[model samples]
Target: MNCRPRIRASLLASCLVLTVSSACGGGEAPHSAAVGGSPAAVVVAISDADRAAAKQTFETVCFTCHGVSGKGDGPGSAGLDPKPRDLSDKTWQASIGDEHLRNVITMGGAAVGKSPAMPPQPQLKGNPKQLEALIQHVRGLAR
Candidate 1:
Protein backbone atom coordinates (compact mmCIF):
# COMPACT_ATOMS: atom_id res chain seq x y z
CA MET A 1 0.00 0.00 0.00
CA ASN A 2 1.39 3.46 -0.93
CA CYS A 3 1.35 6.21 1.73
CA ARG A 4 1.50 8.97 -0.92
CA PRO A 5 -2.25 9.16 -1.26
CA ARG A 6 -2.78 9.57 2.48
CA ILE A 7 -0.06 12.20 2.73
CA ARG A 8 -1.57 14.21 -0.14
CA ALA A 9 -4.99 14.02 1.43
CA SER A 10 -3.61 15.26 4.76
CA LEU A 11 -1.84 18.15 3.10
CA LEU A 12 -4.99 19.13 1.24
CA ALA A 13 -7.00 19.05 4.46
CA SER A 14 -4.43 21.26 6.21
CA CYS A 15 -4.50 23.80 3.41
CA LEU A 16 -8.28 23.95 3.53
CA VAL A 17 -8.22 24.44 7.27
CA LEU A 18 -5.78 27.32 6.91
CA THR A 19 -7.84 28.94 4.19
CA VAL A 20 -11.01 28.74 6.29
CA SER A 21 -9.23 29.98 9.39
CA SER A 22 -7.87 33.01 7.55
CA ALA A 23 -11.27 33.86 6.13
CA CYS A 24 -12.88 33.55 9.56
CA GLY A 25 -10.41 35.81 11.32
CA GLY A 26 -8.23 33.31 13.10
CA GLY A 27 -5.47 35.82 13.81
CA GLU A 28 -6.66 39.11 12.36
CA ALA A 29 -9.31 41.23 14.03
CA PRO A 30 -12.57 41.91 12.25
CA HIS A 31 -13.27 45.37 10.92
CA SER A 32 -15.89 47.39 12.75
CA ALA A 33 -18.10 50.29 11.73
CA ALA A 34 -19.49 53.25 13.62
CA VAL A 35 -23.11 53.75 14.74
CA GLY A 36 -23.98 55.53 11.49
CA GLY A 37 -22.61 52.60 9.42
CA SER A 38 -19.71 54.76 8.37
CA PRO A 39 -16.15 53.47 8.69
CA ALA A 40 -15.02 54.10 12.21
CA ALA A 41 -11.80 56.01 12.85
CA VAL A 42 -9.08 53.61 13.85
CA VAL A 43 -7.24 54.48 17.02
CA VAL A 44 -4.10 52.44 17.32
CA ALA A 45 -2.89 51.64 20.80
CA ILE A 46 0.55 50.05 20.92
CA SER A 47 1.23 48.01 24.01
CA ASP A 48 4.62 46.74 25.16
CA ALA A 49 3.70 43.14 24.44
CA ASP A 50 2.51 44.01 20.94
CA ARG A 51 5.70 45.95 20.28
CA ALA A 52 7.84 43.01 21.41
CA ALA A 53 5.91 40.62 19.21
CA ALA A 54 6.16 42.98 16.23
CA LYS A 55 9.90 43.33 16.81
CA GLN A 56 10.31 39.56 16.87
CA THR A 57 8.23 39.21 13.72
CA PHE A 58 10.31 41.86 12.00
CA GLU A 59 13.54 40.09 12.92
CA THR A 60 12.31 36.75 11.63
CA VAL A 61 10.57 37.92 8.43
CA CYS A 62 11.66 41.42 7.50
CA PHE A 63 15.30 41.26 8.61
CA THR A 64 16.10 39.04 5.64
CA CYS A 65 15.32 41.87 3.22
CA HIS A 66 15.27 45.01 5.37
CA GLY A 67 18.29 44.09 7.52
CA VAL A 68 18.38 43.66 11.33
CA SER A 69 19.03 47.35 11.69
CA GLY A 70 16.84 48.14 8.69
CA LYS A 71 19.76 49.57 6.71
CA GLY A 72 18.65 47.75 3.50
CA ASP A 73 21.77 45.54 3.69
CA GLY A 74 20.20 42.23 4.57
CA PRO A 75 21.39 38.93 3.10
CA GLY A 76 18.56 39.01 0.51
CA SER A 77 19.32 42.62 -0.45
CA ALA A 78 22.24 41.58 -2.65
CA GLY A 79 19.94 40.03 -5.27
CA LEU A 80 17.06 42.51 -5.06
CA ASP A 81 16.72 45.00 -7.95
CA PRO A 82 15.43 47.76 -5.72
CA LYS A 83 16.72 47.48 -2.15
CA PRO A 84 14.45 47.47 0.88
CA ARG A 85 13.51 50.60 2.80
CA ASP A 86 16.12 51.94 5.19
CA LEU A 87 14.43 52.39 8.55
CA SER A 88 17.33 54.30 9.99
CA ASP A 89 16.74 57.28 7.75
CA LYS A 90 14.25 59.83 9.07
CA THR A 91 14.33 61.72 5.77
CA TRP A 92 12.86 58.81 3.83
CA GLN A 93 10.25 58.12 6.51
CA ALA A 94 9.30 61.75 6.71
CA SER A 95 7.13 61.56 3.63
CA ILE A 96 5.39 58.30 4.58
CA GLY A 97 3.00 58.04 7.53
CA ASP A 98 2.24 55.17 9.88
CA GLU A 99 -0.93 54.26 7.97
CA HIS A 100 1.12 54.00 4.78
CA LEU A 101 3.61 51.72 6.46
CA ARG A 102 0.85 49.47 7.78
CA ASN A 103 -0.74 49.30 4.33
CA VAL A 104 2.59 48.42 2.73
CA ILE A 105 3.12 45.62 5.22
CA THR A 106 -0.38 44.28 4.70
CA MET A 107 -0.74 44.89 0.92
CA GLY A 108 2.89 45.11 -0.28
CA GLY A 109 4.82 48.17 -1.41
CA ALA A 110 3.72 47.83 -5.05
CA ALA A 111 0.16 48.65 -3.98
CA VAL A 112 1.30 52.16 -3.03
CA GLY A 113 3.72 53.11 -5.82
CA LYS A 114 6.72 51.45 -4.21
CA SER A 115 8.99 48.53 -5.07
CA PRO A 116 7.48 45.13 -5.82
CA ALA A 117 10.19 43.37 -3.88
CA MET A 118 8.20 44.11 -0.74
CA PRO A 119 5.58 41.42 -0.67
CA PRO A 120 2.34 41.28 1.31
CA GLN A 121 2.34 39.26 4.53
CA PRO A 122 -0.75 37.12 4.18
CA GLN A 123 0.53 34.42 6.51
CA LEU A 124 1.31 36.92 9.22
CA LYS A 125 -2.07 38.51 9.73
CA GLY A 126 -2.55 40.94 12.62
CA ASN A 127 -5.24 43.26 13.84
CA PRO A 128 -5.12 47.03 13.45
CA LYS A 129 -3.77 47.28 16.99
CA GLN A 130 -0.91 44.94 16.25
CA LEU A 131 -0.19 46.82 13.03
CA GLU A 132 -0.08 50.09 14.95
CA ALA A 133 2.43 48.59 17.35
CA LEU A 134 4.57 47.40 14.48
CA ILE A 135 4.41 50.85 12.92
CA GLN A 136 5.47 52.44 16.19
CA HIS A 137 8.40 50.05 16.48
CA VAL A 138 9.51 50.87 12.94
CA ARG A 139 9.25 54.58 13.64
CA GLY A 140 11.52 54.13 16.64
CA LEU A 141 14.14 52.62 14.34
CA ALA A 142 14.06 55.77 12.23
CA ARG A 143 15.25 57.84 15.17
Candidate 2:
Protein backbone atom coordinates (compact mmCIF):
# COMPACT_ATOMS: atom_id res chain seq x y z
CA MET A 1 0.00 0.00 0.00
CA ASN A 2 1.28 3.47 -0.92
CA CYS A 3 1.06 5.64 2.19
CA ARG A 4 1.83 8.81 0.20
CA PRO A 5 -1.40 8.53 -1.83
CA ARG A 6 -3.46 7.92 1.31
CA ILE A 7 -1.90 10.92 3.09
CA ARG A 8 -2.50 13.19 0.11
CA ALA A 9 -6.09 12.06 -0.12
CA SER A 10 -6.64 12.76 3.58
CA LEU A 11 -5.06 16.20 3.29
CA LEU A 12 -7.25 17.03 0.33
CA ALA A 13 -10.36 15.97 2.21
CA SER A 14 -9.46 18.12 5.20
CA CYS A 15 -8.81 21.14 3.01
CA LEU A 16 -12.11 20.64 1.20
CA VAL A 17 -13.96 20.51 4.51
CA LEU A 18 -12.37 23.73 5.70
CA THR A 19 -13.10 25.47 2.42
CA VAL A 20 -16.72 24.45 2.45
CA SER A 21 -17.12 25.52 6.04
CA SER A 22 -15.69 28.97 5.43
CA ALA A 23 -17.70 29.51 2.27
CA CYS A 24 -20.89 28.63 4.12
CA GLY A 25 -20.38 31.47 6.61
CA GLY A 26 -18.51 29.34 9.07
CA GLY A 27 -15.74 31.89 9.42
CA GLU A 28 -15.35 35.32 10.96
CA ALA A 29 -17.74 38.02 9.82
CA PRO A 30 -16.42 40.43 7.27
CA HIS A 31 -15.07 43.68 8.67
CA SER A 32 -16.80 46.92 7.86
CA ALA A 33 -14.89 49.61 6.06
CA ALA A 34 -14.11 52.76 8.02
CA VAL A 35 -15.39 56.19 7.03
CA GLY A 36 -11.79 57.08 6.16
CA GLY A 37 -11.83 54.50 3.35
CA SER A 38 -9.45 52.04 4.95
CA PRO A 39 -10.45 48.77 6.58
CA ALA A 40 -7.48 49.03 8.92
CA ALA A 41 -8.51 52.55 9.91
CA VAL A 42 -11.82 51.50 11.35
CA VAL A 43 -11.93 52.16 15.06
CA VAL A 44 -14.76 51.76 17.51
CA ALA A 45 -15.19 54.78 19.72
CA ILE A 46 -16.73 53.88 23.06
CA SER A 47 -18.02 56.39 25.61
CA ASP A 48 -18.12 56.13 29.37
CA ALA A 49 -21.87 55.60 29.31
CA ASP A 50 -21.49 52.89 26.70
CA ARG A 51 -18.81 51.22 28.76
CA ALA A 52 -20.98 51.30 31.87
CA ALA A 53 -23.92 49.88 29.98
CA ALA A 54 -21.76 47.15 28.47
CA LYS A 55 -20.35 46.28 31.88
CA GLN A 56 -23.83 45.97 33.28
CA THR A 57 -24.94 43.82 30.37
CA PHE A 58 -21.94 41.57 30.70
CA GLU A 59 -22.45 41.25 34.43
CA THR A 60 -26.08 40.39 34.04
CA VAL A 61 -26.04 38.07 31.03
CA CYS A 62 -22.44 37.09 30.42
CA PHE A 63 -21.09 36.58 33.92
CA THR A 64 -23.36 33.64 34.50
CA CYS A 65 -21.47 31.65 31.87
CA HIS A 66 -18.21 33.52 31.35
CA GLY A 67 -17.47 34.24 35.01
CA VAL A 68 -17.14 37.60 36.75
CA SER A 69 -13.60 38.05 35.45
CA GLY A 70 -14.25 36.57 31.98
CA LYS A 71 -12.27 33.44 32.82
CA GLY A 72 -14.95 30.98 31.63
CA ASP A 73 -15.40 29.76 35.19
CA GLY A 74 -18.99 30.84 35.75
CA PRO A 75 -21.31 28.72 37.87
CA GLY A 76 -23.31 27.61 34.83
CA SER A 77 -20.15 26.58 33.04
CA ALA A 78 -19.87 23.46 35.15
CA GLY A 79 -22.59 21.70 33.17
CA LEU A 80 -21.53 22.91 29.74
CA ASP A 81 -19.88 20.39 27.41
CA PRO A 82 -17.31 22.54 25.60
CA LYS A 83 -17.18 25.23 28.30
CA PRO A 84 -16.95 28.97 27.80
CA ARG A 85 -13.98 30.82 26.42
CA ASP A 86 -11.52 32.42 28.81
CA LEU A 87 -11.87 36.09 27.97
CA SER A 88 -8.96 37.10 30.17
CA ASP A 89 -6.48 35.48 27.86
CA LYS A 90 -4.82 38.33 25.98
CA THR A 91 -2.98 36.10 23.61
CA TRP A 92 -6.12 34.45 22.31
CA GLN A 93 -7.98 37.72 22.07
CA ALA A 94 -5.07 39.41 20.32
CA SER A 95 -4.80 36.60 17.85
CA ILE A 96 -8.48 36.81 16.94
CA GLY A 97 -8.70 40.63 16.73
CA ASP A 98 -11.78 42.86 17.12
CA GLU A 99 -13.49 41.78 13.92
CA HIS A 100 -13.40 38.15 14.94
CA LEU A 101 -14.70 38.96 18.40
CA ARG A 102 -17.56 40.99 16.99
CA ASN A 103 -18.41 38.17 14.64
CA VAL A 104 -18.29 35.64 17.45
CA ILE A 105 -20.62 37.74 19.56
CA THR A 106 -22.94 38.65 16.72
CA MET A 107 -23.04 35.40 14.79
CA GLY A 108 -21.73 33.12 17.59
CA GLY A 109 -18.66 30.91 17.79
CA ALA A 110 -20.59 27.86 16.69
CA ALA A 111 -21.31 29.55 13.39
CA VAL A 112 -17.57 29.70 12.87
CA GLY A 113 -16.69 26.16 13.91
CA LYS A 114 -15.86 27.19 17.47
CA SER A 115 -17.50 26.11 20.73
CA PRO A 116 -21.25 26.09 20.30
CA ALA A 117 -21.74 26.93 23.94
CA MET A 118 -21.41 30.55 22.88
CA PRO A 119 -24.65 31.93 21.60
CA PRO A 120 -25.04 34.89 19.31
CA GLN A 121 -26.33 38.13 20.79
CA PRO A 122 -29.07 39.38 18.54
CA GLN A 123 -28.43 42.87 17.28
CA LEU A 124 -31.86 43.98 18.41
CA LYS A 125 -31.03 43.13 22.01
CA GLY A 126 -27.33 44.04 21.88
CA ASN A 127 -26.64 47.55 20.67
CA PRO A 128 -23.55 47.77 18.47
CA LYS A 129 -22.10 50.59 20.53
CA GLN A 130 -22.46 48.65 23.73
CA LEU A 131 -21.00 45.60 22.06
CA GLU A 132 -18.02 47.62 20.93
CA ALA A 133 -17.49 48.81 24.49
CA LEU A 134 -17.65 45.27 25.76
CA ILE A 135 -15.07 44.28 23.21
CA GLN A 136 -12.79 47.00 24.48
CA HIS A 137 -13.34 45.86 28.03
CA VAL A 138 -12.42 42.31 27.05
CA ARG A 139 -9.33 43.58 25.29
CA GLY A 140 -8.28 45.44 28.41
CA LEU A 141 -8.45 42.20 30.36
CA ALA A 142 -5.81 40.62 28.11
CA ARG A 143 -2.88 42.09 30.04
> Could you give candidate 2's per-residue lDDT for residues 63-98 as a string of tens digits?
889987899998889999788888988788767766
Candidate 2: deviation at residue 69, Å?
Answer: 0.4
lDDT of 2: 0.65
| CA deviation > 4 Å runs, candidate 2 | 1-44, 124-126
- Model 2 deviation from the true structure expressed as Cα RMSD, one decimal place: 15.5
Best by lDDT: 1
Task: Put down candidate 1 lDDT per residue, 67-121, tens digits, no spaces.
Answer: 8888888889999887788888989888776556766888898987889899897
Candidate 1 regions exceeding 4 Å error are 1-41, 123-126
> In model 1, which range of ten residues has the least summed lDDT?
1-10
Q: lDDT scores for all predictions?
A: 0.65, 0.65
